[model samples]
Target: MVAFDRPHGMTPPQAQWELPFFNQHHHTLALGLADWAGAQRVDESDDRRACREWVHKLGEAGWLRYCVPAAHGGALDKLDSRALVILRETLAFHSPLADFAFAMQGLGSGSITLGGSDAQREQRLRAVANGAQIAAFALSEPEAGSDVAGMKTSARQADGGWVLDGSKTWISNGGLADFYVVFAKTTPDAGARGISAFVVPADAPGLDTSEHIDVMAPHPLATLKFTNCRVGADALVGTVDGGFKLAMQTLDIFRASVAAAALGMARRAFAEAVAHARQRKMFGQHLADFQLTQARLGEMSALIDAAAMLTYRAAWMRDESPTQGAGTPAYTAAAAAAKLTATENAQRVIDMAVQMFGGRGVRVGEVVEHLYRDIRSLRIYEGASEVQLLILGKAALKT
Candidate 1:
C-alpha cells in the first residue's frame, strides 16, 4: 500500500501512453495527476477514511474544481469530458476509491453545476468544489435503478415550504455528503416528467440515513430516508417537470469518464502483469520468454490500447460536438459505448493479469488481488454493461 501519510508534494509522473490527440495542457494535467497518485498508498483498513482523505487531498490540490463551473470555483465553464476522462483514468490506475471520491463530487453536485440557481450554485457548489463540503445525488431507489419513472419518492407543497417524503437507495457518498441533490415525484400522474430535483441540506428536518452500505469495494454509501423533510421553494432545481432530462444529462457527461476510470485500472493491471511476466521464472525460463506467455501479454496490451482509444474518442466527441445547434450531444451514445467497452475490457485485462500472477494473484492483499475486487464494481456502477448496451443499441437505431 502506498503510504497515505506522505505529504502531497509529488508531481504526476510522465505518462507512457500519451496519444497524439492530447494537447499540451491535457498531457501536463495527466502527468501531474498520475505522479500525484503514484506516491499515495491504498489503505487496507477503513476504506471510508481513505476515501474521505482522498477527497480532501484532491480538493486541496484543486482537482475537484473541475466538477463545478468557473463561477463556482471550477477550472472550466462546464464539465469537460476530456479533462474528466483523463483525471478519472489516471486516478483509477492508482486507486479505485480515489476515482470514486472524485466521481461522486461531480455526480453529486452535477445538478447544481448544470441547473442550480445562482445563489444555490454559489453557496453549495462552491463548498463542494473547495472540499469544504461533500455532496450526494439521490435519484436511484429500490425499484428505480435504471427506470427514472419508477421512483416512489414524493414531494408536495406545504404551508411555507415543500414537504419531501420517501427514500433513495444506492446513494453514493450518502452518509458523508454535506448536502444531497434529491429527485422526487412531484406529480405521480406525469410519470417521468413529474419528477423534480431539490437541494436538500444534510441538517434538514426529517432527513435521515439508516445505514452505511458495505459493498465489494468500500466507499461512503448509504440508504437515505426522508420523513416530511422540509425545504423552501428556492430549493427546487431547474424546472419541476424537467428533472428527468436533468438527471440524464448529468449522467451523459459523466458516463464516458466512468469508462476512463475502467481504462486506468486496465492499464495498471497490464503494466503489473507485464512486469511479473518478465521477472517471474517458469520451469527453465522467465515467463515472458515463453511464446504462450508473450502472446497473452501482447493480447492484454492490445486490449488496453483499444479500450483507451474508444474511451478517448467518446470524450473527444462530447467535447468537440457543435455547440450552435447540437441537440442533446451524442454523449449518451458515446458514454454508453465507452462505458461498455472499457469496463468489459477491463474485466478481461484484469483476469489476464491475475492469471499471469498465478498463485500470488489470488493471495490476500496482492496488488492483482486488490485490483480484482476493484475492477468488478466498475462494470456494475454508473450504468451496468447491460444498461450501456441498451443505450448504445437505441442510439444506433436513432442514428
Candidate 2:
C-alpha cells in the first residue's frame, strides 16, 4: 500500500508530485489530486464527453480555479507554476484526455487572465472557473503551424465591432469549447506586429466548426472557420499588435506543464512495465531477473528523473524570473530547454516501456499502447522538438 496521506477519504496514489522544486502546499495538492485521479476510471468510448466530464469534475473539485485569478474565482492572483505542475501531473496520471481538458481551459483563457480588462475577466474567466463554460486557444492556422506571422486569419475594422474572416486548424477542444481566444491579423502590411487577439464566444454569428480532425488519441479536435464573424470592440484582448507577444508569453508559462504531463504518462507506463517484469516469468526466471531487462528498467528510471528535473526547473525559472510582466530572455531559454529535453526523453521512456512489454506492448488494448499514442502529440504540440532546438540556438547566439 502507498503511504500517501490523502485528505479525509481518497483512493490510492498512482504517482506523487513531490519534488525538490515543489513547496509543501504543492506537495499536499499533488498527493490529494493523485489520489483522487487514481480512483477515477477513464471511458474510452465518447472521449469528448469524457473530457467534458473531466473538466466539470476538476472544476467541482476546485482545481479549475488555478486557471484564473483570485479576483475572478481562481485560487491565486495569477497562474502559479507549481500549481500548474501539480494539476497537470495528477490529471495526466488519470487520463490524458482529462489533462487536455483542464489544460485548454488555462491555455484558451490565459490571455484574458493575463491582459484582459476587468469586464472581460469577469465575463469569461469567472464563468470558465465555475465550469459554466469551456475555453479554446485558436492560434494555429492551415498555413501557419509554427510560424505565427504567416497566419492569414484577418480581422477588419467594422461599424460596431471587428469582422474576423479565416480558418484555424487543429484547435484543441474546438468542437467542445464554449468560447475561443482567437488570434487574427489586423494590419496586412505590418506582419507579426499586425496581429490582435479576441475573445470569440461559441455562439458568435458566422463562426462555424467546419470539421473535426480524427486523431489517434481520439479527443475533440477540429478546424474552426470564421466567415465575417464580428466581435465587439471590447473583445480585443491586450492591445492591437501585441497579441503575438502575449501568446508567446502565455505559452512560455504553460510549456513546462506540458512536459510535466508527459512525464506523468511516462512515470505511469514505467511503473506498469516494472510491475509486469517483476510478476511475469520467462525461461524459469522472472523477467526482472534478466540482466538486459534490469538495464532497460534502470535506464528508464534515470531518463524519467532527468526529465522531471528539467521540467520542474523550467517552471521554477518562470516563477522566479525578474521581469514579472514582460517575458525574460533567460526564462525563455530555460523553458525551451526543458520542453526540448522533457518531450524527447518522454518519447524515449515510453519506447522503453513498450519494448519491455515485448509482444504484449503492441496489443491494441494495452496500457503501454495507449501511452504510446498519448505521447506522440506531446512532441508535436506546444512546440515541436526541432522548433525548440532552433529557439534555443537563436537565444544562445543572441547572448
Candidate 3:
C-alpha cells in the first residue's frame, strides 16, 4: 500500500454549492464538512483498518447522523439526498475510502430505514448512526451481479424461523460488518418476486465471511457463504418476497450520491493537474505556460463542470421533486444519467491528469496513479455505464 501526501491547501471548490439547486443548509454543511474532512488524516496502508477508523471518526463527529433519520439519531428528519451528496463529495475529495465507509452505512441499512418494523428500526438504525455496529448489504452473487433476479441464494421456512443457504460476493464491508442485510429467494420459481431480505449477524451460526477479496483500490470486499443459516422470524426486513423492490429502493436513494463521489474525485484530479502544471518546468517555461497544457486543463474543467451539474441536478430532483421517488421513470433516468456521466467523465479527466503528470503519473505513490485505480470501480459498481445507457434509452422511448 502506498500513501501519497495530500497536497497542502487543496480543497474542492465551494462555489458550486451556491447554485439554485442548493439551499443555505447545504452550503453550511459543505463548508463544515470541508473543514472537518481537510483536517482528518488516517494511515490507509491497511484498507480494512482505515475503513473502520473512518466510520468511527465520522460517527463521532455526527456526520453519520445524516445517514439515517432524526427519529433514529440522524441529523435530518429523513435521508436528505442533497446532504448525502455534499457529504460524499467533500469526503471523497479528501479521501475516497472515507466516502466508501460513509456510503455503506446508508446503503447497507437503507432497506431497514425504508421498511423495517419499529423494533427493527430502534435496534439497528440507532446503532448504525452511532457507529456501534457496522452494516453490509448482501445482494450481488457470482451469477447475479447485474441481473438481480438471477440470484440463487434461498431462504426457506423451518421451525418458526428462516434458513438461508446461498452466497454473496463482491460485498463491501463484508468481513468487517457487524450485520448484513442479506437478500435471498423465498419462492424459488418467482424470479425477482421470490426474493426476501433478512438481517443476519456476522456471528450467525452457518455464515462464513472469512473469504476476503483483494481489489485494485482500498476497498474491503469479501465473498459470503451461508450454509443453512438460521434467523428468527423477527429478522425479516420487509414484507416477504419483496426484497427486490426494497433493494432497488435502497439503491435509488444512494445512486445520485455515487455521482457526487465521482465528481469529487474528478475535482481532486483536476486540482492536482493544475497545481502540477503551474510548478513543473518544461522546455523553457512552466508546464502551465504552454497553450497545449492550457487546452487540456480547459477540457478537464469542462468535463468536471458537466459532471457536477448532472450530479447536483439528480440529487436536487430527488430531494425537491414530489414525483421523483424511487421507481419513477423520470428520476430513475436522471440518476442513471448522472451516475453514468460522472463516473465515465471522472475516468477521462483522471486519465488526462495522469497524462499531464508524464512519467510521475504512473509512479506507485503518485496521487494521480492512486486516483486512476480508485476511479475505475466507480464506473462499474452502483449500476454500470452500459446499464445507465440502457436506462436512458428506454426512458427516451417512453417519452
Candidate 4:
C-alpha cells in the first residue's frame, strides 16, 4: 500500500500534480476526477458506440459542463484551461477513449465560445456543454493536413447562404458527432485569409459520412464530404475571413491539455513500471535491486518530472496569457514546446515500461501494450512533432 499523503520521502509519482503551480480548486478537481475515472471500467470495443457512450456517461456525470461557460451550460464563468488540463489528464490516465470523447466536445465548440454570435453559442456550445450533442472539429482536408492554407474545401456564396463543397478527412468524431465545426475557404483567392467557419449539423442535407477510418488506436474517426452542403447566413461562425485565426485560437487553448493527457498516460506507465520492478526478481534479487534497473527508473522519473513541469507551466500560462482572443506568441510557443516534449517523452517512457514488463508488455490486453499504441498517435495528431519543432524554431527566430 502506497501512502498518498506524501510524508517526507514517501511521495508517490502522482504527487507531482500537487506541485505549487496548482491551487486548491485544481487539487480538488484532480482528486474528484481521479475517484470518478478509477471507478469506470471502460469498454472501447466499438469505436463509434464507445465514443457515444463515453460522451453520454461524461454528460450524465456533469463533468461535461466544464467545457463551456456557466451562463450557457457550464460549471465556470469562462473556459477554464487549468480545469481542462486536469480533466484530460485524469481521463486519459484511465481511458484514452474517454479523453478523446471529452476533448472533441470542447474542441468542436471552442470557436463558438471564443468567436460565435450569441445565437451560435446557444445553438452549439450550450448543447455541447450538456453532452446533449457530440461535436467534431473539421479543419484538416485531404490536401491540407499540416498546411492549413492549402485546403481545397470551399464554401461559396449562393442563394443568400453558402454552399460547402469538399472533403475533410481524419476528423475526430466525424461519423459520431451530432454537429461539426467546419472551416471552409470563403474567398478562393485570399489563401489562409479566405477561410471561414461554420456550424454544420450532422443531418445537414448534403453532408455524407459513409467513409470510416480505422486507426491504430481508434476512437471514432472518419472522412466527411460536403457535396454542395448549403447553410443559412446564421450558420457562419466568427468573421468571414477569420476562421484560421479562430481555429488557431481554439487549438492554442487545448494544445497544453494534450500535453497534460500525455503526462497522465506517462504517469500511469511509470506507476506500473514501479509496481512491476518492486515485485519481480532476478538472480536471487528483486528487479529493483539491480543497478541498471535503478538507473532506468531514475531516468524515467526525471523525464516525467521535466514533462510535467513543462505541461503545467504551459497550461497555467495559457490561462493567464493575454491576447486579442486569437493567441499569444508566448503561450503559442509554450504550448508547442509542451506538446512536443510530453508526447515524445510519453512514447519513450511507455516503450521503456514495456521493455521492463518483458513478454507481458507486448501481449494483447496488457496495460503497457495499450499504452504503447495509445501514445504513438499523440505524437502524430494535434500537430506532428516535426511541426512543433518548426513552430518553436520560428518563434525563437522572431524573438
Candidate 5:
C-alpha cells in the first residue's frame, strides 16, 4: 500500500454536515472519520489483501460498530441511515475501497440483524462487529442482476437439512467471507415468494468460490456455485418464503448509503479539480483565472451540492420519517431519486474533472483518473439508472 497524498491541503467539505438533515452526533462522526481516514494508507497493489487490511483497521478502530446495533456490539440502538450515509460518504472520499469494506460488513449481515434468531445473532453479529469474521450477501445469479425474482438458485429440504444448488454471481467478498447469507428458491414456481435465506459457511462442502471476476474497479467479486450444499436447519434465516422481503429490507437500508458513496467520490473529484485549477497555469495565467474554467467549476459544484442534498434527504427520510421504511412508497421514491441523481451526477462531475485535467487526467496513478474508474460502477450497481427512472416515473404517475 502506497502512501496517499492530499495536495493543496484539500479535504472533503464539512459544512454540509451542519445541514438540518444531520444531528450533532453525525457531525462528530464525520469529523472523526475524516481525520482517521485521511491518515490511513494501505498498499492497494493487491485489491484482496488491501481490502482485508482495511477491514481489520476499520474493525480495530471501532468504526465497524456503526454497521450493527448496540445489542450486537453496534454503535446505535438500531441501524441509523443518516449515520450510515455519513460513514460511507467520508470513507469514500478518502478511498472508495475503504467505503466498500465498511459498507459490506453491514450489508452482508443485515438480514440476520433484522430477521435472524437469537442464536444466529449471538453467533454472527458480534463477530462481524469485531472483525473476527467476514460476511457476504449472495442473491444475484448470472441470470438475475437487478431482477431478484429471476434467480435460479434453489434450496430443498433434504435429510432434515437444507440443500442449495445453483450459481450466484457478482458476489462481493465472495471467496473471502467466512459465511454467506445465501438466498435460493424453496418453492420453485412461486417467483419471489418461493425464496428462502440460509447461512452457509464458506467451508461447506459442494460450494465453489474460485471463479473471481475482474471489474474496472478494485472491488473483489466472484461467482459461487453450490451443488447440493447442505446446512443445518438452524441456518435458516427468517420464515420460509420470507427471503424476498428480507432481501428487500436489507437493500432498503443501504440504498441511500450507495448514493452517499457516490457523493463522496464526486466531492473528491471536485476538490481535486479546484486545487488543480488554482495551481495549473495556462494562457499566461492560472487555470482558475479563466472565465470558462470558472463556469465549469461552478457546474461541478452545483452538481455535487444537488447530489448531496438528495442523498442526505433520502437518508434523513429513512432515519427520521415515521412514514419511512421498506415498502413505503415515499421512502422508496426518495431513495430511488437520491441513488439516481447522485450516481448520474457524480459520473458527470468526475468526467468533467478528467476533462479539466486534459491529458494528465487519464494517467495511470492520477487521482482524477482513478476516480474516473471508481465512479462508473456505482451507476450500474444496487439498481441502475434506468431502474431508478422507471421507479420515479411510476411514483409521478401515482401522484
Candidate 6:
C-alpha cells in the first residue's frame, strides 16, 4: 500500500504538496493557517448566524487581511493569487464555510479592488479586508446565471443616480453581506456592453432578502429583490456599460481559488480513505490486503496529485501575470483549465473515498458525506465545467 511518513518537525499538509512555483512564504502561510483552521470549528446548526460568526472570527484572526492591497490596510502589496490559493486550500481542509467566508470577502469586493476609484477602494476594500463587513457578489439572477447577457435586471439613470429594478438569486452571503457588487443592464438593447456594476449597500431601500434558499449543502443564500432600489452616482463600480467585463474579470482570479478549495476537500477525503483502508478488515485480512482496494486507493491518490499540480500551475501563472489583466486571453484560459480539472477531479476523488467507506460514507454527518455534498456545487458554480471547456476550446482554436 502507498505510505507517507511525515517529517519529525511540524509539516502542514499544504507544505507537502508545495510546488517549485511557490516560495517559502507560501508554505509558511499554509502551515500557520492549517493549525488555525483545525482549532476553529464553526457550528453549522444555524448556517446564517454561523457564517456571520465565521467571517468575524476569520477577520479577527487576520486571515482575511490578504483579500485587498496594502494601500487599503491589507497584508500583501496586492491580492496575491498564490496566497489566496494556500488560504483557501488550508481553510477548506478544515471547514468549507470558513473558506466560503474568506473567498466572498475577496470575490464580492474583487471588482472594487480591480477598478474602483480611489475613494471607492478606500471606502470598501479596507473594511472588507478587515472583515469589519461581509461582502457578496450579486451577478447571477433567476434567468441569467450562465447566460449573463440574458439578465432582465435594469439600472436606470435617475435623479443623478441609478434606480435598480430587478432581483438576484442564488447569491452567496446574500442576506448577510454588508454590501454587494451588483451587475445590471444600463442600456436595454446593448447586450453585454450595456451592463454596468454598482456597489449597493445591503440597507438600500427596497432591497429584500426575505427568501432563504436551501441547497444540498447548507450555507447562507437568498433571493434579493431590488424594486426601485437606488444609489448615488458614486456607487457605480468600474466603467458604466462595463459590468459584464468587470464580472468576468473578477471571477478570473477567484476561479483558480475555487480549484484550491476543491483540492482541500479532495485531500481530506484521501487522508480519511487511507486511514480507513489500513484499519478496515474483511475476510480475516485488512482492507489494504485486497488488490481491489489497493487499486482504488492508487487511483484516488493519482487524481488528487494531478489536480494539485494543475491548480498550482494555474494560480502561479495568474499571479505572475500583470494585475488589472485578468481578462487577458492567456490568463483566462489557464484559470478555466485549472478550475475545470480540479473541481471535476475533486468530485471523483471524494466519491471514490465515500465508496471506500462502504455504508458508513453515506451517513448524514460523515466527513466524506459532507465533502461529497460540498464538492458537487463547485463543478457547477464560478463557471461550470462545461463553460470552462468552451473557454479552453476557444483559446486552443485561436492558437
Off by over 4 Å in 4: 1-14, 321-326
Error of 5 at 270 (Å): 0.4
Top model number, lDDT: 3
TM-score of each: 0.94, 0.94, 0.98, 0.94, 0.98, 0.95
Candidate 4 TM-score to native: 0.94
> lDDT (CA) for every model shown?
0.82, 0.83, 0.92, 0.84, 0.91, 0.86
Model 3, 1-399: lDDT tens digits are 322247777778999999999999999999898778767878999999999998999999989999999999999999999999999888877788999999999999999999898998999999999888899999999999989999999999999999999899999999999999999999999999999999999999899999999999869999999998999999999899999999999999999999999998998899999999999997989999999999999999999999889888888888888787556888999999999999999999999999999999999878888889999999999789999999999999988
Summed over model 1, clashes come to 5
lDDT of 3 at 305: 93
Query: How many residue pairs clash in each candidate at the backbone level?
Result: 5, 0, 0, 0, 2, 0
Clashes of 2: 0
Candidate 6 lDDT over residue span 1-399, tens digit each = 001112123223754546797988887887777666655656776778878887888888888888988999798888888899999887777678778889999999899999899999999988887789999999999999899998989999899999999999999999899999999999989989999999999999979988889999888899999999999999999899999988987898799999999998898888888878888988999988999989998998888788888788777887775752355788888888889999999999999999999999999878888899999999999899999999999999999
> Residue-wise lDDT of candidate 1 within 278-360, one digit each (tens)?
77887988988999988998898788778778888777777775741112537567667778999999999999999889889
Instruction: Count backbone overlaps in model 4.
Output: 0
Pick the winner on TM-score between candidates 1 and 5.
5
**Model 5 poorest ten-residue lDDT run:** 1-10
User: For residues 64-104, what per-residue lDDT tens digits would candidate 5 score against the true structure?
Assistant: 99988999899999999999999998888888888899999
Q: Which pairs clash in model 3? A: none
List the candidate 3 regions with Cα displacement exceeding 4 Å: 1-4
Please tell me which model should have the higher lDDT, number 2 or number 5: 5
TM-score of 2: 0.94
Per-residue lDDT of 1-399 in model 2, one digit per residue for the tens? Answer: 011212333332334455567777777777777656656655657877877887887788888898988999998877898689778866665567888888999999999988888899999898889788999999999999898899999998899889999999999999899999999999977888999999999889989985889998777999999998988999899998888888887898799899888887787677777788988988999999999998999998888888878887878777665662237777777777878887788789889889888999989767778889988999988898889999899998997
Estimate the overall C-alpha local distance difference test score of candidate 4.
0.84
Q: What's model 2's lDDT at 73?
A: 98
- Candidate order by decreasing lDDT: 3, 5, 6, 4, 2, 1
